[model samples]
Every structure is written in C-alpha cells, then in structure tokens.
Target: PEDSSRAASVVICMNTDRIRGAPMAEAEPTRTPQVDSRAILEMDRLHVSVDGATIVQDVSFSLRPGERLALVGESGSGKTVTALSIMRLFDAAGMETRGEIRFEGKNVLTMGMPAIRALRGARVGMIFQEPMTALNPLKTIGAQIAEVLVRHEGLGGEALRRRVRELLEQVRLPEPLRVMRAMPHQLSGGQRQRAMIAMAIACNPTLLIADEPTTALDAGLRKTIMDLLVDLQQRLGMSLLLITHDLPVVRRYADRVLVMREGRIVESGRTDEIFARPGDGYTRTLLEARQVDSMVDAVDESAEERLSCRDLGVTVGKRRWIGRDTLTEIIRGIDLSLHAGQTVGVVGESGSGKTTLALALLRLMDGARGEIRLDGMRVDGLPEKRFRRYRRDLQVVFQDPFGALSPRMNIAQIVGEGLDVHEPGLSRGETRERIRAALTEVGLDPSVMSRYPHEFSGGQRQRIAIARALILKPKVLILDEPTSALDAAVQLQVLRLLRDLQQSHGLTYLLITHDLAVVRALAHRVLVMLDGEVIESGSTGTLLEQPTHDYTRQLIDSALMT
Candidate 1:
C-alpha cells in the first residue's frame, strides 16, 4: 500500500455540484454525481515567518471546487497567517515566505503582481474576522458593496444598485433600501457582517476564505451568519476555507478539519473522525477546550451580599474626536445590588453601556455620579481623598490581561500592588508571601510570580488578573468580560474557578458580558441593557426563558437560534 503512488487523502473531483460531503441518504443510486473540473486552491509545503519568528512550517492543504475545509486552532496559533498566505494578502517584502501555492495548478509563489492581482476579489474572495474593520466607514453600505462589483465585473449605474440591494436581501438584512443608505457605523455588528458577506460573494468567486467571521456576533446572529454561509456555499458550489476557533460551528458545518499549531498542520482528517479522537496533543487540547463551557462556581443565592450599587449613574464630558458636540451619558440612572457570595450578571450587545457601567462602578471614568456601597458605605461621589480609603473594599478584573498588567512589573508586584496600596507598613517579605498565596489560589505556579504578563497564554494571563484582584480580598469584585476572550473549554474552566472562588471567599460579583450562554451558565439574576437603558430585569430563568419585552425576546431568540 505504501508503494502505491496514490494520494493519501480523498481525491476531490472538481465538479461544481459534486461538493464534498454530499449526503447520499436521500439520493437515488442511479443518479450520477457531478464534479467541477477545477482546483480552486492548493498550498504545498509552505513556510512562513513573522519578524524572524517562524510561524508556519511545511504546512500543506488543498481545496477543490465545492469543498469545505476548516482550519482550527487557538489564538496566535497561525490559523490566520496561513489563510493570509493563501490570499497573497500579506506583504511579501518584509515577512519571509517559502513554498508553493498552486491555484488552478499554477504556482502562486512564482506569479507576479499582475497575475496575483487578477485572482484577488475576482477568482478569490475573502471575508474578514471583524466586519466593523472590514466595511468602509465613509461609504454607505450600498456604495461599498457596489465597489466590489464595479472593480471586478464592471457593473455600474442602476444595475449595480439593484445588485447591491439583492445581495443585502440575500443576507437577510431587513429594509435593504434603508440599510443600503446607512454607513457601517450606523449598522449593528450583525448587519455590518451581512454587508461584508454580500461584498465578498459579489464576484461569485470559486473560492471563499472566512476568518473568524462570527467572533463579535451574538448567538442568534452567529447562527444566521453560519446558515447563510452554508446556503450560499451549496447554491453557488463555492469551495470554502473557514478559519475560526469556534468548535460548534466546525462540527456542525465542516466536511474536513485541518488542525494547526505553531503554524503547522498537525492533524487533518474527516470532521467526525478528528473530533472523535484527535491525533495530536494540540488538537485534543483545542477540542477539549471547546467541548467545555466556561469554568464556573455554583452560585449560593442563600449567601448574603458583601457589596452593592444603589441608583448608580456615571456621566462624562464628551470629546470632539468623533464629531460629538455635547456631553454623552454613558451609563443611565440604574439601581442594582450584589449580595455577598452571589453573582449578578450584566449582559448587552457591543457598546450597550455594559463596560461603561463597570467603569462607573469603579469610578474609573471621569465625572462619575452614583451610589456605590461597599460593605454598607456609600462610595459614589466620594472625594478622591475619601475614595482612597474604600479602594481596598472593591476591586476589578479586566478583560485583557496583557493590557491590565504592567509590562515592567513582575507577577509578584502586580498581585501585591493592592496590598502595598492598602497596607503600606507591610514588609517586602510579607508582600512576597501574599503574592505567592494569591497565585496559588488562582491555580498558577508560585514560580510564575517572577514572570511578566507576556509569559502567559490568554487564559493564564486572565487568571493572573483574577489573582491580582483576589489578593486584595476585596468584598466586591467586578468581572468585565473575563471569559469572553477565552475558548469555550478555557472559558468554562475560568467560570468554574470564579464560582469556586466566590463561594470559598464569600465574595460578591458583578459580571458584565455579551455572551448569553455564559449568562445562563453563571448568572442567577440577569439584566439586559440597550442604548444605555435597562430594558429587561429578572431572574435568569424567567427573563431568558419567557421574556415579556419584545427587545428581550429578540435578544434571547437571537442568542438561542444563532
């Protein structure tokens, strides 16, 4: 068998209708399969390096007409870089690249700018990770989408307008005419994504590469986007290269799975086979991480609250950076309470004022107004002089560990900064002991106390942030999107850790998040906000399961079906 010169993998016959993973259960045996006679794309033993650091080595994968392949891995694992290489999207001058990319059996590495340019946006189309960044800010959605058609196919005038509107309707954006007139900034995150997808598929390219296309979307939006992609793929018979960290999408949609780590394809197999028993350690870890939800501690509603916010409001003078003339009310008047040993979940879409509310609670935002009670003492509107005394009673855990921690400071100093601030008379040795204990509580090795934030993974860096907060032994802990950045399994782990810590220390928590699944898993009571307004408030079971408000129902429906 080894001596035979056949390719090891399945031979993808290039037929537009003969897509990979076609279901045969409902088909008649007499019906012949159709194959598109084209090789959409291929990567051969490619090597890539970033800033002298090798990222991908000898990575090879292929796509035929009407095939679907998923490239999956953790952040910084090179899944994106590989896709960039395929598109010839990355600049070739500074970064080093070696290997062959065969498109229609022609080596792309040997091609000139003219030949490569002819392929991009015409023969090859790409959907970016962040639609907010992908769509143009200055152009209306219709104009922006039309540009792709104009540049690639020379469609103009009334034809282009009609095509653009049709494209919007295909992506299921309501009121296509009205949405077309709006700019990217005016559209919701999901709407902008739909527009971007419309632009990508405008040219009807043979290949479509999607890079983390649903990261910013809620559950409902994610589902809609995924379904749209699947429907488009089937209808157009386009070969799809999906790059994402989302496991559920991969299992439900992908035909083949390509596992990447440190820029190499460590495992490639049928989707079900790879998911059932991953061949590589990295693949197994990635799968395991996705399978689990956020780590969480069971909330004890019976426990008392250590801290709470009563009728909180924060206002700040608006800057002229975005053409705003007057002051902006970020957090509207709101009343919320946190019981000791209980977790309260705050949820909303992007820019829904959730983070603003958290910042207000910490009094971090300038010109704050509200009543923040820590251990029964009013903290809001307290003078800086008086606020310093209560700082130890409340602490916050940030979403990004890399930005939150000081680059120059070691873990010991980062964790002990709270102690040094509140208890200055303590000796250096005492601080070191406290830091070590804090690291242990967060399940990190005490040896890491000397390392900087860069010396950790996303999950580890987040744990360090938690450790820093826990070291303060603050009565109230504000967690802001703590697990959103993590993969599913790592998120599950972190959630469980927070719950355990909350129960063991009898800590009160105010969690702000956009993930409803997480809210369902972690929150006892749920608060829904939109446009600086608290539109829905009730227990998690009541609000999420049977919402009275239309807005709340839409939110819940979007999250569930997406």
Candidate 2:
C-alpha cells in the first residue's frame, strides 16, 4: 500500500487490472483443474485495520468445499471485514489487512493483482446485503449480468442475452424476460435478492460469500431466499461462507459456525453442537435470544393522528428551573411534526436523549419546557387533572415487554387499567368485554386475559403491551426499541404488525432505536441524535445513504458492520 498513514500486510499479491487507473474489473480467470482440495477457502491469523484502528484480529478458519460456514456476530464484530478480506477488497476502502488468506491451496494475500482480481468474481463471488445499492440504478438487470459475463467469460450478443435469461431462470424468478428488462427498483425485495444471487453464481465460483443476504427481507421471504441458496449451493457443488447475526438462520442452514467478538474468533464448532451447548458467554447469550409467536384481530382501516412540537427541551431536575439551580438540559431545541399514519424514527447511541425526548413528549417527565400539541390541542404545562384526559390519546410501548408489563397483574387488569381510570362507572361485564376486544385487536387470544404477563413469551408480552395501549384508543404510540428484544423472525412479525396497525387504525408513531434496518422498515423520517442534540435530520433514504454530518456517517457506517 502506498499511503503512509494506512498500511496493509498485502504481500504485494496482484496482477494489474486495466482499471488500476479504472475501477478494477474481474478478469477471465484461468480455471485450474478440479481437484480434491482440503479446503475451498482458508484464512490464518488474519488482521484488518482502518486508519490505525483494529477491527478484525487473529481470525482463522477454513471453509470446506460444498459446506456452509456461518460467521456470526452483531454489527461491528468484524464479520464483514473478514469476508471482504477473502476477496481482497480492502484496498478500495482504504482499509488494511495483514494475514494469509488461502483459496484452494493458493494464498490470496500473496497472489498477484490479476490473480486476486480473478478470485474476486471468477473464483469467489460476493453477494452484498442490499441489492438496491449493489445493482445499478440506470442499467437494466440483463445488462448488469451480461457485463459480468462479458468481463469474465467474454460472451457476446445473443449468447450474452441468452445467458442472462438463463441466470434469471436459474434463480427461479418468474418470466425471466420481464425480470431481465426491469430496473432494480421495479422489482420487489425478494426478486432483487434473487437477481443478486444469479450474478454472484454466474461464473460458478468455487466459494460464495453471502453477507447478510436476507436482513432486509420479511420473515417469509428470508426463509424462501435461504432455501434457494442452499439448493443452488448443493446443485452447483459450491461452498458457502454465510456472514450474518441471525442465530435462527445459522441453525437452519449453516453446518459450521465461527463466532466473532471485537474482531477476534471466540468460538468455533458444528452448528448443532454450538446451539445445543455453547461454550462462550456471548455465544450462549446469542443462542438465548427470545423466540415467540404473535396474533392480531382484524380492524377496519381508519386513520386520524396529528402530533407536533417546537422549542422543546427537557431538563433533568425539579419541575422548576433557574440559571443557578443544579439542572441539566438533557434534550434541547427539538422541533418535530407528524401527520396521520406517519412514523418518525428517533435514533442515537444510548443516553443520547432518544428516550428522554419520548418521555418529554409523553408528559411523563417533569422539567420539560416546550410547546406540545396533540391533534391541534395545546397540552403542555396542563395540570395533572387536565392532562389525565390526554393520556387516553397518547401511549407508549417500551423496549422490554417483560420489564414494562406488570407481572403481578393479570392480562385483563393490565389491558383494562386505563379503562378503569377513565370510565370508572362502566359495569364489570362491559369492562371485561372491552378488555377482550382490545386483546383481540392486538392479535392476542382474549381467552388468555386471565393469565399473567410471565405466562407469555416475549412476542406475546409485547402484544399484550400493545393491547394495553390500544385499549384507550390512543392516537399516537411511542415505540421505544419495541422489537429489539425479540429474535430476527419475531422482530419482522412485530414490525409487520405495527405497519398494519398504523395503516388500518390511522395511528402515528415515534420510533426510537439504534437499528438502521428497523428505521428503514418503519420510519418515514429519521432524526440522528448525538450528545442530547439533533445533529442531522432527513427523509429515511437520503440521510442513511448520504448523511451530511460526520457523526451521523460514523453511526451508519458502524451499524453497517464495516
């Protein structure tokens, strides 16, 4: 590497691509004779760094031919770094890697430029997490795939077109011709993912690198795409290196597992053995991630919610504040507006005022000075007695359902707690009926009303919490990391339920979380907070893809598992 500030232990392995000046294109690789290699891909004592910061350290593993190996960890656990190192792509991002990465008896770290470039697409194909970004916006799907074939296999004209159609068909997409002509955004998420797979496997690479392939898809589509990948891997006789944080996916598909933490390999074993009896503490915690089922009642679509605020600031002290007093301004200068059925996501690191802002808006915290209006009615600074009525119009669903739901209270009492305060004169029979209706509205069995919160799973308890909020027919819900405590599949189920409820009931949402995926899934607008201040705010797509603030960019990049 030429840069003095950033160095890579690259071992000078490269054969110049025409693009050294242009972006390097994967060259037509000289296919070696098929041999029974011990390992399709192998790495030893690998280390990756960027700007003098260590990300991946001493990671070693081997992926056997036709076997599925899962590299498991949360974001920033160095999963992507290791995967990218295998393809030798760190140079593009100004990152450095020092270690031996061998592919089929050849150390890629020692291979020449052309040799490494050939390995990128011709020998080891990569499927990135998001296809919308991976696929060209201006190019047709057919043209993109053809470009790959032309660069590697040198196909032309009718054959190139024919191969593109064949790839679409191979991925089991309906009407190859239609998909071939369609632009990326024109296709659904699942269809776009399938196209990505077609492009990755075009040259029949010996090893396939799938980096968070299904993170963007819904619960059902995740399974379908994985199933397709497994089938293709088997039929094509290719090894798969799956990089993901999903424990359930690893259990369902991966044969071997490599657990990473803080850039180091903490554990490695067969998938069944690791799940059945994990050795590492972090590995066990990941295995113990909650799993639960959910249900909801059908409601007629009716939308009506409006929330806005200005000059809002919440101080951590008594209700009164003075310049000399010991008061701290935790949240300041917040301006927000939400229309009916709108979802605004509040994202930041812990203690960054996300939760404090929610409390200020809900009027749950004291020392909050701001102009707050709900549905065009000023509610700020109202007396306790007067504001109690507005409590029925606003509600909150917390991050941990187990912590929020009262274990001592039965489901009926929990859901009907508000009804008792607001409609104290209602008959017992009427109260019970309303509670039942509320539980049914949130997809919970009304029959379970007699059970306590501890009797339910994580997902069920969250639904109970939602039912508790819905019992009052609130116009707005403050969802504080509502789905973070659930498993990946359960997370999607809850997100889908939230979207449906918002559309049908015309309810508004203020979502607070650190997950960008969740933000993209639910939020129409996003506010990036830092040090109790709003540093950047914009529409979901623009801000996430092209952030203007340095901290906001760092936040997104960290979440991106770089």
Candidate 3:
C-alpha cells in the first residue's frame, strides 16, 4: 500500500492492535444502540495483501441482521478491498487473504469455487461504485437483472421477464416496461444506479455490500438512493455494509461506524457517538472538514467582463432511418456574464445541462448555437483554424481527472502540451520552467513530472489536471466538478487552493458542479439549473439562504439533509 502520510491529514492512522482488541463502549442515550440483534456477518482479524504488499491489516468488524454498518475512509484505505474479499472477487493468483470471514456460521475463506458461486448472488449481493461500468452496456436492463434470477433461482421465460419488471418497480424506476427494454447507457445516472440496485436485490440476498453507492450522484438523487436502500433493507430484512467516504450519509443511515486508515480500524462505535465526540484525531479532522465556509470575496462590478454568452443553446440527436431525426435540447437560452477575477458557480443535478453549458461556452460541442464572447471578442462562430488563438485564453478542467488525462503521457508532457500548442516560440527549457511553476502552484512536487498519472492518487491527479489548465495562464477557467472525486479533507484542500489561486492571479472561473458545498465555498454568484434552464441566479449567500424557486429549495434541503 502507498504510505498513509501521502493521504490527507484528516485520515491519520491509529494503533491497529488496540482497535482490533478493544470493544465499543456504550454510546450516548440520544443515539441508537449498536447492534443488539443477531450478527449475520463477522470479519475477525482480516488481512489482505496484493503482490506481497499489505493493503488490509488485521481489520475486524461485524454486521447485524437488518442493521446498517458503514466502513468509512479515504481512498487506498482498504474499504473496497475488504468488501470485495467477502465475495472472493480478487484474483487468487496475485492476491492473498488470511483471517476469518464468517457468514451464517459458514467460513468463506475455505469455500470451494462452486460454493462461492452459489453464495455470491443468492446470499451476498454487491452494488459496485460505478454503475455505468457495473452494468453491461450492450445488454437490456431486464436481461441483465434476469440473469441473476435465472442463474440462482432457475426461473426463465415469462416468469423471468415478469420478475425483472417487478424488480424495477420495487426500485421505484419510472416506466418499468420502457426501462426493461432500455440499455444501461439509455438511462440517466440515477436510473442506472437504481437498476443496479434492482439487480443486487433480485435474489433477496441476506447481505448487500454497497461501495460508494452515491459517489457521483447529485444531492437530490443521492438522498433518493439512500432512502431506497434503507427501505429495501428494512423490507427485506437484510444486513447492509456501506463503504463510502461520505460521513454525512454514514451519520444519517449507518447504525455502527467503523473508521479505517491504512487498512486498519482507527475508531469504531455508534454513528452518533463517532460524530458527536470522536476518539481519534483523524476522525475529528474528518468531521470538521465537512463544514465548509464561504470564501467569496467582495466583487468589483466595474471590472472588465472576461466572458459573456447570449442565447446559448445546444441540441444533440442521432440519425434515424425513417422520418426526421429527433433532437433533444440540452442547454436552453442562457445569458450570462463573468467579470475578471470573479467565480460563478452553476449548480444542478445530473442532466441539468451544467456540463453542456460549459462545453458550449468553450465551443467544444459540435451542435452549439449562440453568441460566445471571450475578452470582448466573439469567437463562437469562428472556424477551427481561426479559433486556435482563443484556445489558450480558455481552458477546462474536466470532472474525471483520470478520464481527462492521457494514460500514456507523463506529468511533464501533459502539463507542457498546452505551452507547446499555444506558445510554439518558447524554448524547451522555458516550457519546463512553466510546468514546474504550475505544479508548485497546485501543491504538487515538480519531481513527479516524469511519473505517469497512475502513480499518483486521485487528489494528486486532480492537482496535476489543475496544473495543466493553469500552465496556459488562461483568462477564463472552466472547472467541471473539479473536487467531486476527492474525499472531504482533500476537497477542502483543493477548494482552498482554488480560492488562493483566484485571489493571487485574478483568474476568472466558471464552476460547474452539483456539490452545493463547493459552490458555497468559492463562488461569488450562483446559478441554479433544472431541465436545461437556469431557474434561479443570485449571490451565493442570498440564493442558498433564501431560495425562491422550489427546485433550488429542494436541492438545498437535500444537501443539508445528507
């Protein structure tokens, strides 16, 4: 495992032996008792290693029947690995696991291949982190869900189709019949996640392992998914093992909380007690980091406008064999302006056209129509050759840093590519100096420039992405969900870095994200979007505190609840 010191200070490691031997004390009377019922799953001194490197070390935890147990930690903390080990999902050739994993009085480690296969869906089901990758894109949603039922229960034909539709309805999916025929890509993020949940619960497994189930979902959708999971678990009388970095969700949904650091349990107790008075410093830091403060400074209204858009719209569709092709408008008529040194946050749920608007503003989308002005120059209608001059002035940091970055390129090549394209006159030595400066600005070591993206952590990769965007010294930077992939502590660090950079360089930012807390932290103004339209816009404090639009109010309430 990578050194724990590389992680955020909020995820400090504690003594592993003490955590393994100690018993959870009684929590405050205000909180629910920690697992008084019968235990359905028990992991005692579990140790997992990959290629002879220890990832999970002497970890121990238990899940009571019908109870919610949360395994909370940052990335590389062995939360996912421990959960995957329960189902023997890791490659046996390269991975080694020791210690006891008991489910219903049966040892899982000694189970044969046939027994493991029978146990996976029928007794223990899992909902992976990324539903898009988990669900087969080529297969219909009904066929995917029915596969589990047919394999485990031997139901086929009409009975299989009927059960699949029933499962979709149980998960509260709309248009069950249509959803049954729809492919994974045809559904929205929340709908795809719901379908994955339906598949996991298709067999009515005694235990369900949800790995960051709501990681990429917006506040409203996240709340809905959490509620659905709780309702289903209660109705079906199954144990829930939730692995996530979201502390608020753990506090609200989990009965018992286990805080992990460097593959060891640092703290374990009732959720309320853990949040109320954490025993470890790491836990306290994690709790404190969740509280975000406003960082918007006083704005100069008379400052020069860095970017402006008029009647911006984007429509996309596919060709059909018969009749005219259907087009769905992604971004509606949007009129907005951003002044130099100001940060404007566009907040919305998935498919709200936030990303579409960002792409349209940057002229990256093919079907975008409308006026896009940068630095008092209209470049929206410019041809590709003519638009090259404006590309350096406008840069974008995408949501997924890993996806946005080239896997084959090293940090120096990735960050310096902008300079090579925009400033061809600059010498190689000059380009290297600029890359080093940008890396230092984003809190990353310049020595790692030779390393590929896979060598760095998620937070580091995001920093590298920022370095790449900043290397151009753009007048307008479009940040799309820049910090959503990080843990709370790392997110706080990134937000602070952005605020500092904005103040130091007078950088203008178009922040597009579903995270209201991030918007609250850095945005001077906020625009609420719903169904491809900007429903509300105002100062961050005014809009978030007293939102007039019902959709905006719903978003805020859901965020606060989580």
Model 2 lDDT tens row, 130-200 = 46556777888887777777766778999788877877776667779978977875554456767887777
lDDT of each: 0.73, 0.74, 0.80
lDDT of 3 at 43: 93
Model 1 Cα lDDT, one tens digit per residue, 1-562: 1111111100111222232222212221111123754566879899988678787899988887777889987766777778877756665445889999998888887888777766663567677755654555678988877766665557789977877787787666777997898887655555676777777656566778887767655665566677767766766677889998778778777888998877778899888899898878888787665443434455566566566676666565555777865565766778887776777888877657787788877877775676777777777767888899787778899755555788799888888888888889989898888889989988899998878885566678889999988887888888887876566656777888887887788788788887887777777788888877788898877888798888888887666543
Q: How much does candidate 2 score in TM-score? A: 0.51
> How does each model score on TM-score?
0.67, 0.51, 0.83
Candidate 1, superposed: residue stretches over 4 Å from native: 1-37, 46-58, 65-68, 74-81, 84-210, 224-240, 251-255, 261-304, 314-331, 366-368, 401-437, 445-456, 541-550
Model 2 CA RMSD to the hidden true structure, in angstroms: 19.8
How displaced is residue 514 in candidate 1, in Å?
A: 2.7
CA deviation > 4 Å runs, candidate 2: 1-37, 92-94, 290-507, 510-562
**Top model number, lDDT:** 3
Ranking by lDDT: 3, 2, 1
**Global lDDT of model 1:** 0.73
